[model samples]
Target: MTESLHIVCPHCHTTNRVRADQLASDPSCGSCKQALFTGHPAALDEAAFDKHISRSQIPVLVDFWAPWCGPCRQMAPAYEQACAQLEPRVRLVKVDTEAVPNLGARYAIRSIPTLALFKNGREVARQAGAMGAADIVRWVQAHSA
Candidate 1:
């Protein structure tokens, strides 16, 4: 039998049980049927971000970025690659710093492309700057369960 875990829907806040192995295939929410990971980060706002970070059973990796930032744009593809590799194991997310300035200030983000790892409703580790897919995976693996 395959192990299954609950993933909170980013859209509707519904919880869905997803088999461990089907994560990379872009699992959808049972209720909304929305693609869980579309190979890109889900743009999370303040309320959704709070709920996701606090209640999600899986580890969440958030990319804090701004649209006008050159480095942030450059690192987008690498983040997507990491999502493809780390899906199910990690929930890939993105927060637009411009839209949610409070979150960026709360996190004390000093640079674009800041990645924060959250598990069990708390931040365990964080890194600044762009990293390749494998490097991102290694960073999360080292810091999270």
Candidate 2:
């Protein structure tokens, strides 16, 4: 039998089960029918963030940032590039601290451009400050492994 994995939809917040072996084949959400892994970070609000963090079987990498932070803006493209390289294996998300202050506080995020890696519904590792695409990818892979 093939092992399966749970993936939360970036578009609809619905959870779907996919075969582990078929992950690279481009899976779609059962409810929304949207592609599960888009090569860009999903912008998550409070409720969606909770669902994705708690329900997803795959690891989630979140960029905790604020709109007014220059470093956050500077790291945006690198994060996007990391998403392109990491997707289907990891879920990349963005939580805007300015809009979702509760999430930032809940995570005790003291600085902008923080990267938090979650696995099995809990944070396993975190990094502060901005980083390039290769560094982001390397950090996530190291932590997730």
Q: lDDT for each of the candidates?
A: 0.87, 0.96
Which ten contiguous residues of candidate 2 have the minimum total lDDT? 20-29
For model 1 the local lDDT of residue 15 reads: 74
Off by over 4 Å in 1: 1-4, 19-27
List runs of model 2 lying over 4 Å from the truth.
Answer: none
lDDT of 1: 0.87
Could you tell me how far off, in angstroms, the CA of residue 21 lies in candidate 2 after the best superposition?
A: 0.8
In the range 1-145, model 2's lDDT, one tens digit per residue, is: 9999999999999999999999999999999999999899999999999999999999999999999999999999999999999998999999999999999999999998999999999999999999999999999999998
lDDT of model number 2: 0.96
TM-score of each: 0.86, 0.99
Top model number, lDDT: 2
lDDT of 1 by residue, 41-96 (tens): 68888888988898788999999999999988988888889987887678899999
What's the distance in Å from true for residue 111, model 2? 0.4
